[model samples]
Target: MRYKGTKAGAIVVAAVTGSVVLAGCGDGSGSQVEGGGASPSASRSADAQEQGTTEVRAAYEKTAEAESARMTIKMNLAAAGKRITSDGEGVLDLATGDSVMTITAQDKTIEQRVVDQVLYQKVPGQNAPSGKPWIKIDLEKVAGQQGLSNQQIGDPAQTAAYAKAITDKDVTKVGTENVGGVSTTHYKVSVDVSKLPGGEQMSQQLGPTLPMQVWLDDEGRLRRQQIDLTVKAPASASAKPEGSASAQQLKMSTVMQFSDFGTEVNAEAPPADQVADMTDKALQGSRQQS
Candidate 1:
C-alpha cells in the first residue's frame, strides 16, 4: 500500500516504528532451561520438571483462534522530545473469504479513514476521490500465496522462526503490568536486525539493532508493544549549507495497544467491484494531481 504527500511521510515514520516494535516483542523461542549442581539422574529429573513447567507456560500463552473482532488501538509517538498522539478503532473481520480491517479516526471533529492497511489524513473541504479512502489487504490471498493462516501465531512452524530470531537469553522479563485490568507479563526483547528478512537494507537506512517491549496477556496474546527507533536524516539533506546544525542521532518512540479482540465468524466481505471502483477513483485522483 502507498500513501502519498507530506502526511504520508509522517504516517510512515510512525507506522514503521510501530510495526518493528510489534514484530520484535512477539518473537521469542520456548526453550528448556537446565538446573545447576544436579547429579546426572537428578539432572534428568530436573529437565523433566522444567519441561513440564515450560509446557504449562506455553499453554497459558496460546491466544484465541477466532478470526475476527473489533479493535481499538491508541498510539503515542515521541520524536526528539516532541509528542503526537492518535486513537484508531477498527473491525477486523477474518471469517469472510477475505480478511478485512476497517479503521477510522478523528482528531476532534475531523474524521479520517485508514485504507488498505495504510493511514491517510483526509484533507479538509476535499472529498476523497474514491468513496473509500482506506487501504485494504486481502488476508486470504496473502495466506493462500504464502501458505500460512493468520491463526498460525502459535503454530510450531511459525514459532520456530520467531524462536531462531529471538534467543532465549535475549528475553528479559520485566515483571508485570496491568493492561485493561488484566495483569500481564512485560518483557524486553532485542533482535539482531541483521537476522531479519530486510535487515540489511533496514540497517543501512534505519539501524543495526531494534529493541522492543511487549506486554503479553495470560493467554499469550500480545496486548501491547513499544519500540525505540532511530531513523537517520539523509546525508545530503543534513549537509545542506543552509540546514540546521548537524546531529548524529535521531530518536523516536512508538507504541501500539490491542484490545477487544475476538473472532468475527459471520462478517460479510466487501464486494470486489466496489473495491475496484474505489481504487480506480483514488488512483485517478492521485494522477491528476501529479
Candidate 2:
C-alpha cells in the first residue's frame, strides 16, 4: 500500500512545552495507545508489514475527512538531567492548523489558539507588559529561532506528514487491543524517522531510528499512537539549556490519542485589545537583552 503525502496538520508538543519562554507528559489505561515500550514477540512477516502499512495509510486518509477532532497528547522525557512531562487537550480544525489547545505541565497550564501560522497563547497569571491576557506568536518566527521547520513545530499538514512517515516495512502486528476502549488492531512499527516530514530535525538530534506503535479501528481511523526516541546531547553553545547541572541526553516518549472525529470545534481568537503580538515581543526582548 502506498502512503500518500497529503497536507496533514501537526502540533509538535515537546518543544512547545520546553521552550524557556515557558517550560515543559502519560500513557494509558486510555492512553496506552502512545508508549513505544510494548515488546511484541510475534514473528515478523512481510505480508503483515504490508498489511499494516495499508491500514495505517488508510487511517490517515480516513481521518483527513474528519473536519475536526478531540486531540490529547501526553509526553514524558528526560533532558539535561531534568525530567519533563506535559498533557495537552483541545479541539483541532483538521483542515486548517487552527486550534484551541491547552497544555498542562506541572502546576502551570497555558492555552493556545491558532489561526493558520499565527498563534495566540494565554499563559495564566503571566501577561504582557500591556496586561493583555493573550499573546500572538508567529510560528514562523519561533521555527527560525528554534531551528525547526514549520512541520516539525506543527503545520496544517502535520498529521498527513506523520502518516506519510509510515512506510511499508518493519511493521509487526502485536494482536488486537482496545484503544480508548475501542477494540482495534495493534502494531509495533519502526521507521527511518529521518525520512518523516519533520524527521530531518529529529535525525539531526537523535539519530535516524524511531519506534512507533499504533492502534487502528476497522474504519481506518487511528484511535491511538505511541512513539519513543532517545538522542545524545550534543555539546554546543545553544543546545545546553541554561541552569542545567548535568550532561544528559534527550529521552522522549509520546502518545497521541484521537477521538470524537467530525466534532465541530469552534475555536476562535480573543479580542484584539486582549492580544499582544509575541513576534514583536520576542524580538523586542532579544534586542533589549543584547
Candidate 3:
C-alpha cells in the first residue's frame, strides 16, 4: 500500500510509537488524590506525593541507563465501530537508539528496523511497484513537515520526555504490584502532552494531559508501562450519509513489557539495492498528479 500525505505520516508515527513510547495495558486502579487544605494532615499527604514523584523519576532515569533490552508491545485500537490489535517484539539499544522489531496485525507481519534515526520496513508484496524488499523513511525529513523530531522517534529519546512531565503534585504511588511475576511498585502520573515530542499535534485529539501508569522493579528498572488514549471523531467525519458506520470516538490502549535488560541488539539498514525510498516515490507521484 502507498502512504500519502498526513495519512502516511500518521501511520509512520504509529509504527514509531510501537518502539518509542513502549507502554502496556492496565486497569485504572490506583490511589486517588485526596483534597488538601493547609492542615497538618494535608502536609503529610504533600510529603508523600513528593516522595512518590522522586521515586518514579529515579526509575525513569535508571531505566534510561540500560544498554539494551528485549521488548514486546501490544496495541488495541478501536475506531469507527471496529477494533484492530497489533503485536510486536524486538530488541532496543537504549544507548544508540537502534531497534529491530517485527509487528503483526490483521494476519500480516511487518519487519521494521530503526538505524540512525531512519526507519526501514519490509512489507510482503507491497514493494512490488519498486521491485524492492524494503521501504525507507527519513525521520528528519518527515519531522520537518510532521512536527516530530528524530530525537523523539527512538526508545530512549521519548523516554526522556517523561522526565519533563513528572511533577511532585501530579505523581501518586499506587502501592506495590507484580508484573510478569516480578515484584514492582506501581506509579501513576499525568503526562503533559505539550512536554512530549510532536505533542502539539496530538494534544488536539488526546487533550492536554495523558494518564500513564508505570511499574518499576526493586532496582528502579522499568518493568512495564501503559497508556490509554480516547479521541472523539471530528464533526466533519460524521458528515457521511445516514446509516454509515462512522466512528464517534476512537480508543487506543497500548502495553509495553520489558525484559532481559542489557541484552545485545544488532540492527542495520537494508542493502541499498533492496531498499526503496518511499518519500521520493510519494513526491514523484504528487508531481505526476499535479
Tens-place lDDT digits, model 2, residues 1-290:
00000000111342432110000000001111222322344444544556566565455546556767887878776643456577888886655646778877656687877775677777688777678887676667644543456555444344444544555554567899877778898877665556565566657655776666777787766677787766543333145564365434457777777789888877787899898765755534322321
Q: What are the RMSD figures for all models against the true structure?
A: 8.8, 10.1, 6.9
lDDT of 1 by residue, 59-95 (tens): 2124323444455545554433445555554454322
| Candidate 2 segments exceeding 4 Å error | 1-44, 156-165, 197-202, 229-250, 279-290
Q: Which scores better on TM-score, 2 or 3?
A: 3
Judged by TM-score relative to the true structure, which candidate is superior, 1 or 3?
3
State the C-alpha lDDT per candidate: 0.42, 0.56, 0.62
Q: After superposition, how far is residue 67 of candidate 1 from its true place, in Å?
A: 3.1
Q: Give the range of the ten consecutive residues with the poorest summed lDDT in model 2.
A: 1-10
Instruction: Let me know the TM-score candidate 2 reaches against the reference structure.
Output: 0.69
Q: Residues 1-290, candidate 3, lDDT per residue (tens digit)?
A: 34543223333434445333432111121222222213244777877876666566566457656777898878777654557777889998765667899878767787888787677887676673578888887665544333335544554445545555556655678899988888998988776667666677657556888777888899877788787776543333345554345434557777787889988899999999998777655444323322
Give the top-scoring candidate (TM-score): 3
